[model samples]
Target: MLQGDSSAEGTQPPDIEWVFCESIVDAFPLLEEEDVAGIWMSRTSLPQTSEIRGMMQSGLMLRDMPEGVALLDADLRVIWANHRLLQWAGRPSGTPLGMTFYELLHNPEIMGPDFCPFHTALATGDESSSTLHSMDNQYFQVHAAPVRSAESPRNLIVTVGEITDEILQQQKLAAIHQAGRELADLRPNEIFMMEVDDRIDLLKDNIQHYLSDLLNFEVIEIRVLEQTTGDLIPLLSVGIDEEASDRRLSAHPRENGITGYVAASGVSYVCHDVQNDPLFIPGVADARSSLTVPLVLHDQVLGTINVESPDVAAFSDSDLQFLEIFARDIAFALNTLELLVAQKANTAQQSCDAIHSAVALPVDAILNDAVHVMEGYIGHSPEVMDRLRRILQNSRDIKRTI
Candidate 1:
């Protein structure tokens, strides 16, 4: 209802009209009309209007939030969902009202630390949280809290946020670490029985498998630096041109391709555009991007690992980081292999020295005894003397060989 007086100049005022609504929510539609100036509820309904207004204020805040927000009734049905929630569900504003919370999300699987979050919130009247994996391979973090009133808990307020990228990245990191561990997983007996070439081949196969399967890298090249010659020796190459694999390279920043620069400077390099990057040399045919990281261990650059792709700007900073980490593992594995070879060679040399030491004195004593016997039998027994002379020559030969 509205009331206004006529002006003292005798101008008549516009006619007043009264409108009635059953509740504040019903009155909201009328407020949008041009003719409706404002809302007027009876004095007895003021408290209810105030409560509804408070709820509306909260809803307005939730509507524009980046995270999905919803108000669920005691039965877990969605009483109201904000704009973000509706957008995520691909639904209109009022469509989700009577649907269950999970139904709105296409019945996502609850990945738990708290599987029954809504139930837990309702029962305990506290906040509960969980993870959800949707049918489309999307991940979400969900938190539910009870909305309480004077009489009892009437609804649950739920918030959901997308975590698909975060979860996938974490899983990939874990897999990379696992693959790294498997790269050098050789028993002592296996190391001892296998030849150097065989061991290197095994390591190469493991690296290729993990790079192609886990990292989704098809083109790769690994080179080991010869410390004495500064030569970059190819340890493994895959999906690379034969000429590039066999190309002679040295650890000179300006001489060889990106591999040499990374080996010499011990810095990772990302070539966003192969044609534009001066340091990049063709590896995979028609390659447009490349990533190279020095295989570093304990501050020393052992070698370099390079990967290429056909797509432009295919790799990112995160790719560089993951490759750097995996390169460290490769360096450690190569170092361990070298150490095993050195240890085996050292053991063999030590064994040979021990045998020579043990046989040296016995051979010398036998030679001296044979010479003395020969001198005594010189005239008496020419046959025995000749046999002793032959024995002396053979003993000397044995000592020399030992």
Candidate 2:
């Protein structure tokens, strides 16, 4: 076979595909060095451009006047631009034809600062939605559709639309109103509404006043409801007067009252009273007025925020309203932080359980062995009996748990 594969071009190898080759020995008998490459090419007939155009026209037609549509190449270079998008860009349809995204806009600031959704989607392969684009000097929302073919997945088509002017104006007005409320939060009463849902290890205290002072409480604090326990624990309070400041009241909160209510109900509680309110614990001094807000995310209560001041009726309706908004925002931020904390805790707990389980048996076995070993020496001492009794009792308790 190897002899037959020889030719003037050097060697013409046997067609190994005609027989099964299981190893280099089998291949060596059927193939030669010059026959390593076996290649052939042939021409095929294809339809002309006119026929392709007719096929395209027969298949589909634009049914609606969507705001804008564009096509892009594998490199995300704009290949074609529809009239609507050209108008949005303040240019003729063919103007952006040869230009890349960076060249077309003269600024490559992510999907948004200017080009937005399209830029964002291409960069992240993640869908983005924006109801308004403020950079074009004309308000509009844009969407991108990436067109990919089974044969070539990198090709793309992006379709964008300009939402009506009326909707854009409404969005702008809403922004202004929201900004006005955000601006009124002048106090450093930063409220960290965290979870009380079977997750807390330590409690917060004058930490609120300390934080308010730190964050400017004239702005924020972690709130807690002053409660023993029950429903409607609408308040989460934190903020310290000179007394509550000096005393970490919640180090171990005795149940039943406003603080407890906040923990139990997970509702944002507001009370202008600090010392005399039904939520305030008796014998606790220097607290004046208070506001307790729940830290909630995904309809679940994490914990409550309590803000307190030494002055009588310190919190006003504006304070209550603005703080509630802040509380809602804070809840989201806290939830993010909680994910990290919970992950770390779970890891540490797994480690601790592993260590405890490993050590518990060895420790008990060693203690028992020590008692047996001492029986011949220290066992004679009268005091050893009492010591062994105490150790044995403790060991029994430890063993029961393990």
Candidate with the greatest TM-score versus the true structure: 1
Candidate 1: segments with Cα more than 4 A from true spot:
1-66, 82-97, 148-152, 377-390
Task: Report the Cα RMSD per candidate.
Answer: 6.2, 25.4
Clashing pairs in 1: none
Reference-based TM-score, model 2: 0.29
For candidate 1, give the lDDT of residue 77: 93
> Candidate 1 residues 167-212, lDDT tens each?
9988889988998888877666777878889988888998899888
- What lDDT tens digits, residue by residue, belong to model 2 across residues 329-348? 55554455456456667866
Stretches of candidate 2 above 4 Å error?
A: 1-255, 282-284, 344-402
C-alpha TM-scores of all predictions: 0.81, 0.29
Q: What's the CA error at residue 16 for candidate 2, in Å? A: 99
